[model samples]
Target: MASPAGQFHPWRHIITFLVITAALYALVFFTPGSTAPKLGIDLQGGTRVTLLAKTTNGTTPSRDSMNLARDIMERRVNGSGVAGAQVQIDGSNQLVITVPGQNNLEGLTRSAQLNIRPVVARWANPAFVAQAPVTTAPSTTGPAASPSATATGTSGAASTAPSSPATATAQNEATTPATGSSTVTTASSGQGLRGEAAALLPKAASTTDASTTTTASSPSSPPPTTPATATPTGTTGTAATPTAPATVEPPASVFPAGSNPGVLTQPAGSDEAAFTTWETAAKAYANGGGPTCAQIEYFQGLDVPDKPLLACDQNGQFVYLLAQTLIPGTQISDATSGFDTQGGHGWIINVTFKADGFKTWSSYTTAHYDRTGGTNPPPDSMTAFTLDSQVLSAPVINEPITTPGTQVSGSFTQQSAKSLADSLKFGALPLAFDRQESQQVSAELGFQYLKAGLIAGGIGLLLVVVYCLVYYRLLGLITILSLFLSGGLVYAVMVLLGRWIGLSLDMAGIAGLIIAIGITADSFVVYFERIKDEVREGRTFRSSVPRGWKRAKRTILSADAVSFLSAAILYLLAVGDVKGFAFTLGLSTILDLVVVFLVTHPLVALTSKADLFSHPVWSGLGNVARAGQEHRAVAARLQSKEA
Candidate 1:
């Protein structure tokens, strides 16, 4: 190892420090769009939303599920293009989400309930669509029937359908058309019929007429004689022509009792009758009428995977009647959003399914899609992707999806697409969630808190500076310069960290920086005191500087190491605001050591070589050095007498 005197290269250390400081400042201000360190939610103000989960039955969700929910929620908030958002589970069933600045709390929370159900049918909302007049003529092959016949009772007003067994049987018999009655048949089923059926079928069915009427001079093929028609009594219509009767099948058995006992088996048969029955029941229930707040509450309480569901879109502009879930949301393995370059669809979400989900999805799509290029594919070909019982998207499957991946394409903006992709990728929550509270913090209030924190820090720094100057004399200038260097390094590091790792500084972090001042000052005082002691032992100022630093180096290392370890422990264990405090404290503690070695010790040693350091008043240790010389002379006189 080099001797203490040879180790003092004050110019080299000082020059190196200047270069580093210049580089840090360049990174802070010269980088494109670079700014000061980011501020936390408490310092910048933001919105907080609390959601309470509701059980399908009546119990709390498992801890694992709650944790999983929190993680998924965090991803969703982050994916929405919001930074520095925090998501945590409160107690057993509540989730608290905090986001910087104003956010769509409803949109963020609604994504938690991902329901992947098969779309039984879909149609545009007439209330939201332009109304076109319809021309009707008597059917040549069948009878004249009103196109709006089935639309009765499907008005916006709430209406009830037959529920009791007796009423249902009576209504079914009354609505059934006679075999020989005049009926109109179209090439398609449920086309152009108004009311419940209109709402259930795809948009393609809305433009075509249900009647089989053909003009006398028309060149089209003759209409089928056995065409089906909408029942005159406004009941659900059957197919234009019925196929052979289906074989009698056994009723579906009940699922085994468990936490969820209502999971129903897939009903057998691809017959038109089975499809018609399912469609009719679903539409009647959905179109029955507007639900009351109590009814909506009751519906929200139900999350059974096996039962048919009735829900409205997020905007509540249209209601949906969804079939039992063919593939649950949990089966989805991953989902990502991007633009469809080849297809030219605006934005799309690509979804990949697990093994079981792949099988279910492929089978469902195969059954509904028209493999033979048939003119009319079943309405069930379309699938509805819902979140919290609201349909996010409903797309028709043109071909069977045999692979594990599928894409949902629509006119989606980037933000909406990403939000949906994130929600789907995270899978569905086990329990449903209801918004409990929404709180907003104003920017002005956050600014006030930040100002107060800065003022407090400034006061503490001022007091430390005053104390250092009064006691250490000229050495106080060195202490102040070391502090300045340390502060500069810390500020640069904070800015770079914020840019790269999203490390935001809050009021608690400011407090940590303030405390670091004393820690740094203590190191300076330790080194200066050690120098005074060496001078008192008859050492020159130049020699004492290096000797003092050599002795104080080990003590400084030990003290800083302990401080760093404590800060590390606190940072690792603490959460939220406390973490910010520990992080800054730990970071500054490391910087303290750098300043001492590179700036403080080297500067002191260089200054000691100057004549000003020998003056009794200019040099803080002049008196101590004089006293030591006198004591040394007495010791020498005693030794000479002994000789």
Candidate 2:
């Protein structure tokens, strides 16, 4: 068998290419934004919210809605600064949002209702639209109802011009308060004001009010049918059925708008009318709507400008509007939630249930669905849920929802549900979170980590170089070159990932990159040692290259495979900064395999032809190691044959 002295000549191009690729990635990173890459939250600051999605309509939310929600949240996060934030969806409807704090926290919370709409000259929504709109004439609403309230439009902007009475009336329907007990205030009812088409549709069908009539004899109230049936996480389910999938024909264009984003299956006009009709009927289903389904429940954004709202409650279900979060001084730190408590999952906002809240909830539902037909429900049975707000599952309310401070179960995820409850229970925001996790972030901490990484990496490199020289002697240069090739490739990947995926080199990540150096060198070690072993066994350079490869490949594959598996497992399980470490570790492991196969082996094959192996001084290995039995016995035997 011949030695691998110069069997392959083309490998030089590959090593050069890898080095250049690494160089380009370094260029991409370390540049300014626009030209450079972005960082992650830990390196920056901001609020991160995890929302669990509950399909209000009994089906899973569509991919489009989920993506749109993520996009909208990102917009809200980025709107704070040119330093963009990230919003991504995990699982089905679960969203993870990260925004840089940049010293403004309330600004971040206000962006929470990213799903709210912006339409009409006024904040014309398909919501309550009721009450004596503080600007309008006095209704029988509580005295707290004022006529001089300012109203924000659907887009969350103050309307440019004052709306006409009819316009005000229309816009008022859409304006509801934040969804907290402390935030709920009184307003007049706005149910009967909707178009005739909406009223007629529900009249076409009727449900039994048997649940209400039998309440006196029933031992326990039946629970509402929640779309989320305690299903295990990661379980894929079938699609949902629309409550009132419109059978009506599409209008060509131009119809009275409702809350549903015109992005419907049919034309916007048809969807709009259907939503309006649905709104009217759904309102009836809530408490203000009818006795059987009077009250409707919803989570609202407090910043909506309108005041003393008259909501639409067409059915007999209880209707709720999210009041604003509690004010600071009004909250008590030691407060707790009780079943009798009207606020959050179990928080009391410390404020009394004001009269205004009563009028807003009860009046709307009473006006629409107070009348009962023996055990039979009225013709208009509403399918109650929020228009665009991230509605958890809205259960079918088969009975009148009456009681002060009752809990509205949206069947939300623990996080989102808690957030809604927290907003309601603790309405005040004295220390708005500009940052979810903040550190001193002095030059001391960053520099300390940086200096430590440099020291560790330097020590590692020094050891590899020293060991190579002590053993391989002339061949040590080749070992050093191979190390550089792998390092260059790893560096390139880090820079590219930072640009595309917001990766950072914290302490853990640096540790990962440093650890990879040994793994990479080990591959080269296996090959180098095998070559020396073969040479001593009497093989020539050409044959040893492939022969050495055959012996080394097994060890290389086994070692790399273990490293790759560890990285994959860590990446899946670890959260926060640890993920960065796992990612880098995994990436470097892959690159090491590539470098060993492509650069290290090829260079060795080419260098073998330079006559260094036959000479004592120029070979890439030391005198004692390379000068073993292969030098004396093999050279003597071959010389005799030649003679």
Candidate 3:
């Protein structure tokens, strides 16, 4: 340990380290929000998806299912190019995900309803034997009969039946809906409910007809025969003939439950136009057509009070679509989730309805099971059981349907099928979502804010530079050199902090740097002021330096410690951008001590021996200020002689 009069101080190294830290901070922070690196949503945008827990035979999707679902979803989200996306469970079954620097994303922000739906296709199987259909033709035995002769009351539409497979196919195509029926499949009067439902189906085209599949004739086989025999009555039916009666395309969906855009039109008698029209309407409606998306307006052109169509309900993410015989007072008894015992292998869903449901469903669907109906047009059959004007299933009610909670089955994938089952069991969402706000953000504006910050920083730098020149003169070089060291130190710290602990510098932090400039100057001022006071009292610069340092250390430590404490407290309590201010203030307060003791003191000690500082012109101190500062040894000698 050296005496108080000793020229060198042990605390000097700590000061040097602090100056280096400040310099590092300066370099890193000067880049707008990054003067130190600023963190953003882009670097870390979060993942969002809606989830629906099973309500019926759909068990509340098991915890394991939830976990597995989370894993699968996480994989999908992370795989989609977002790095560092974190997925976490929100509630018992909910999940939340986040990433960095993902500003203004156009992501589908709806709850995820993963499911496996069976691929449903129309097949004209032999009523006698269940056979897969190769084409749309309902291959029967002999004389091509009118469509009315086969299935009675088939959607209450009039048309001739095809006894030959080719003609049956043409009838299927003729029955398909046309125009905007997809959106407006139903009407209030229910005058021809089944006719409308039939209209929604695709005109099953036979290989023999050009109207069947949209392809040209390859003159190989004979053209398909459509019964031109006027059905006992009168009505013109357009039929498609195929050279080869084969199914080259999928049959139109019968009950393709989709959004209804509130308007749909049916072309007069074209199979192609009718099928295409239905497709358009079902896909356009969203959110159950309850209310319009803020971006899309709500427009309900058709609906009835007796049988109102319900969109996605309380649990909007889930939908309850039933193909049961319509029952007005059916009460639900029980419901459960499909089991995935082998870890998501085969899933099956179940639901049970009350006794009343069993009775109503039986009556509502089987009213026209075997009954033959009258058709004013050429040949007609009663149409039945359609949701959104699309046939879900059209098995002629051979017998009354009596079972409660009837099971619906077809080609379903694991996720889609399960999702549908859950929705049917859980029901719809209660409230509707209306977009309250929608706006686009610009990086350009962010850059402008950054520019304003830089300008302010430049002004602070100029002031610090000028003050040092006028007050310290040649000695002021210590301030300039110390600032350079501080800037480097601050830069390194910020980079490491951002990369490791997620520290960032914002506008507030920039302000802290500016304020820090003054704090550093204060430290130097304290030391220089003390030295001047000592010299005015007749002490030499050497003697005054040690005394000045001793006194300034306590004041600097006390002041800086307060600043550090305040910053720490603010950082702990503040949210968002405010923390940036606290972080910079704390960092700069610490570096202030570094410049004063390390660069300022050491340089002053070495400069005391130089002629430049000793000479009044370079030192900037007047005769009055320099006093005995130049030769304090003479005072010491005279005092000793006097003693």
**Deviation (Å) of 560 in candidate 2:** 0.9
Candidate 3 — which residues are off by over 4 angstroms? 1-36, 39-444, 626-643
Could you give candidate 2's per-residue lDDT for residues 1-643 as a string of tens digits? Answer: 7859765554565756666765676576555433422333444344555565544244566777777655555544443222335567778656666553332223334323211111101111222222112121112223322344332222111121111111121221212222221111111222221111111122211111101111111213222111111111232231111122123422422121232222211112234455455344334433222211111112122222221111212121112222111112122222112222222323221222334543443443444442332222332322222222222212122233243332333223333433443344333321111123322222224445567777999999999999988777767777898788778766666656554334555666777889988888888788888887777676666567778878898989999999999998998786555766787788889988877777777777776766865454656543434577657877899999999
lDDT (tens digit, per residue) of candidate 3 on 592-626: 77666666777777777677776667766556355
How much is the lDDT of residue 220 in candidate 3?
Answer: 36
CA displacement after TM-score superposition, residue 244 of candidate 1 (Å): 40
Candidate 1 per-residue lDDT over residues 1-643, each given as its tens digit: 7568645578899899899889988988898534688787877877889999866545888898788778777766654221457898899899998876566665565544555676564433333332223222233332332222232121221111111001111110111112211111111221111111122343323221221111122224332222121222222333222112113321222111111222111223345455455456445433323232122223442455555655444333344557777787788788877866654445667777889988887787777753322234345654666655555554335455556766555446676777777778765555567788999965544888899988998898888889888777788888988998898899899888875545778777888999999899989989988998898897788888878998899989999999999999997787667877888998999999989998998889888888885565777776777788888989999999999
Q: lDDT rank, highest first?
A: 1, 2, 3
Cα-based lDDT for every prediction: 0.59, 0.42, 0.42
Worst 10 residues of 1 by lDDT: 164-173
Q: Distance from true position, residue 314, model 2, in Å?
A: 27
Q: What is the alpha-carbon lDDT for the whole of candidate 2? A: 0.42
What's the TM-score of each model vs. the native?
A: 0.50, 0.42, 0.37
Best by TM-score: 1
Which parts of model 1 are misplaced by more than 4 Å? 1-8, 31-34, 40-44, 50-94, 100-439, 443-449, 613-616, 637-643
